[model samples]
Target: MRKAAALGVAALALAAQCAAAAVPVQGYAIKATYPHDPQAFTQGLFFKDGFLWESTGQYGASSVRKVELATGKVLQKRALPEKVFGEGIAPHGDSIVGITWMNQAGFVMDQGSLSIKGTFNYMGEGWGLTSDGERLYMSDGTPEIRVLDPKSFGEQRRIKVTVDGQPLAKINELEWVEGQIYANVWQSDRIARIDPFSGRVLGWIDLSGLAATAKAGKDIDNVLNGIAYDAKTRRLFVTGKRWPKLFEIELRPAKK
Candidate 1:
C-alpha cells in the first residue's frame, strides 16, 4: 500500500514538471497588412534590392518569378523545365541561389539578367534553402540544418533542431535573418525561430487558423512554405506556392 502511494505521488510530480516546462506565451502584435494571392503553393521566396522573388513546386509544376509587393503582380517569371522541380531560394551577394527538388542541382543566377551562372551538387533531397550573407543553410526534410560552403557547395557541419525538449522535424522553407534561422513546419501553419549555433528553438510563431483567412478561401496552397527577410527594411515575407497572397508580418511574443 505504501509503494502504491509513492508511485502515484511520483507520477503526479512528473505531470507537474511537464506543465512547468511548457514554453510560455509572452505576447504578439501584427506589424503590417496581409497580402492576398489567387494561386497558392509557394515553394521558395527571397527579398533582394526591394524585389520579392518566388519559386513554386510540384513534380512538373515549378517556376521562378519576381513579384511587385504592393501590387502582387508578377514582374518577371521563368518557368522551370517539367523535369526540374523548384525549391527554396536565397540571395548570395549579387546573385540568386535556387534549388531544384530531386534534381540534386542548384543554380546561381544573375540578379539583373536572370541568367544562370553556375550549377552545384548536394547530397540528399533539397527541400528548403537560405543564406546568411556568409554561409548557406539547407534542409533535407530533417530536424537539422546543413551548413554549406558557398564556394564549393560542400557540407561544413550540421546541427539538430529541437524546442523545449521536442524534436522539430519536417522543416521546410528556410530563411536566415539577424543571425537566426526561421523555418516553416511542413504541412502546418507554424514557424519556428531557431538558434544558429545550438539548434534550439528560441520561440515559435504560430500561424494557426491562417488557413481560414479570407484569401485562403479563394485559392489556398495545399501546404505552406517559403520565407524571406528584407535586411534594409526589416520586413519578413511568407507565402506558399499557389497561395493567394504573400504576407509581410511583424511577429511579437504570444500572449501570456
Candidate 2:
C-alpha cells in the first residue's frame, strides 16, 4: 500500500513540474466592495440567485445564513446543534450542504426555507466543502481533496493537493472555479489554485496583508474564511469573519 501511494505521488509531482511553467496568474485590483458583518464568523461563502450565503463556525456560534448582498441583512438563519462545530458550505440547487468540524456529519438543508432535509456521515472532520456540478469535493485540513457522490456523500476518489512539486498542506476552504480547485491554506492569507486532474498547485492567490484593513474587535473571528465566485458574472468575492467589507477582486498573474 505504501509503495503504491509513493508511486502515485511521484507521478503527480512530475506532472506538476510540467504544468508549472505554463501557469500564468496575475493579481488584479479590487473590482467591487459589498457589505459584510463585523460580528459574523464566516466559515463558508457561496453565491446563489443574487444572494450571498454564509456559514459560520465555532461551537456555540455555528450557523448558516442567507444575507442580502448590499445591506448585509440576514434573510434567514439556522443554528447548528450546540455540540456540532460548523465548517464549510456549498449550494446544491435549492438546497445547501454544510459540513461539521469534528462531528463527521454533513447536512442538506432546504435552499428556500433553510430547514434540515437530511444528513450523512463522513470519515473525517469536515473542513471545506464544494462541488463541481456533479460530485462534491471536501477537505479535512489535509492536502487531499476527497471526491464523494453527492447523493450518498460517500468517498469515491481522493487527490492530494500539490504545487510545483511541493505538497500543500492545511488546505482549508475550497472553491471550484473554471475546472480548477482553489483552496485557502489554513492560518495563512494565501489561497492556492490547484489542478484537480493531478492535484498540482499551478499557482497561488496571495492574500498576505489582505486582512490588514479589518480591525479586530472583541469576539471577532479573525482568520480569513470566506470565498465565493459568481460564475455567470465572473466575479470573485472574498471576506474574513467579522470583516467590515466583502471585496470583489480580479486575479492577475503574479510577475515572475
Candidate 3:
C-alpha cells in the first residue's frame, strides 16, 4: 500500500462509481472480532490453515508476519530491508511471494521458516496481491489488475476494473474469494466484487459503518483496506491500517 492515498481516489470517487454503476451495496454484520496489531500498517492480508498472513508497510517498519487469528499473536515475522517498503504478499506453492513499493523487486521466502529464498522482478508500483492456487493477481493502485505467472512473474493479462464503464481506480489490498476478485477501493469504505473474466464489478460491499474512524475525523489514512477469506468455513475477515481489532463478518442485504 502507498503511504498516502493517491489523488482523485477518495470517498467521493467511490460514491461516483456507485452512482454510475447503480450497483447494489451489501451491508455486513460482525460475527466475531479478534485482536490485531495496532502498529501493523496492513497492506496485504490473507487466511490459510487457521492463520492470518499479513504484510505491513512503512520504509523502516515493513515486515511480513504470520499471526494467530484467535489472539493476534505474532507467531512469526521477517523484517524487510530498512529502505524497502513492503506492499503485498501471497503464498505460492511451498514459498511465500511478496512485492515492494516503487522498486519493482519481489521476493520469495520459505513458507515455514520465513527466510528469503530468491527474488523476481516486475514492472509498476505494487499495491495488493493474491492468488487463485494456479496464478497470481496483482493491483498497482490503478484501475487495472494484472495477472502474472506464478513462477516467472510475467504479466499474462490485465483486467480493467470498471463500474458502469468508469474505471475503478486505486484498487488496493486484494483477495480472491469464490472465483471473484475482492478489492478495496483505496481510501474508501467500499469493496468491489469483480468478475475476473469480464472485469465488471458485480456489486459493492459498503463498509461505511465499520470505517467510522475516518468519519469521526480520526485517522484518515486508516480507512478500510485489508480482506481475507477462509474458504473452508466461508468466513470473511476485514480490517484496516492501525486498527486494534479485526472483524469476521457475514454479508447481509442492505436495509431500505
Candidate 1 has an lDDT of 0.78
* lDDT (Cα, tens digit) per residue for candidate 3, span 1-256: 4534654467669877667648777888889988888888999999987899999999999999999999999999999999899988998888889999898999999989999999998888999999999999999999999999998889999999998777889999999999999999888889999999889998889887885632323777777878999999999999998888899999998544
Q: Candidate order by lDDT, highest to lowest?
A: 3, 2, 1
Candidate topping lDDT: 3
Model 2, C-alpha of 124: deviation from truth (Å): 1.6
Per-residue lDDT for 178 in model 3?
100
What's model 1's lDDT at 173? 91
Instruction: Decide which is better by lDDT, 2 or 3.
Output: 3
**Cα RMSD for candidates in order:** 2.9, 6.4, 7.9
Error of 3 at 214 (Å): 11
TM-score of 1: 0.87
- lDDT per residue (tens digit) for residues 11-82 in model 1: 999977775456543223445544545563577888887878887787667777888888878788777778
The lDDT of each candidate is 0.78, 0.84, 0.89
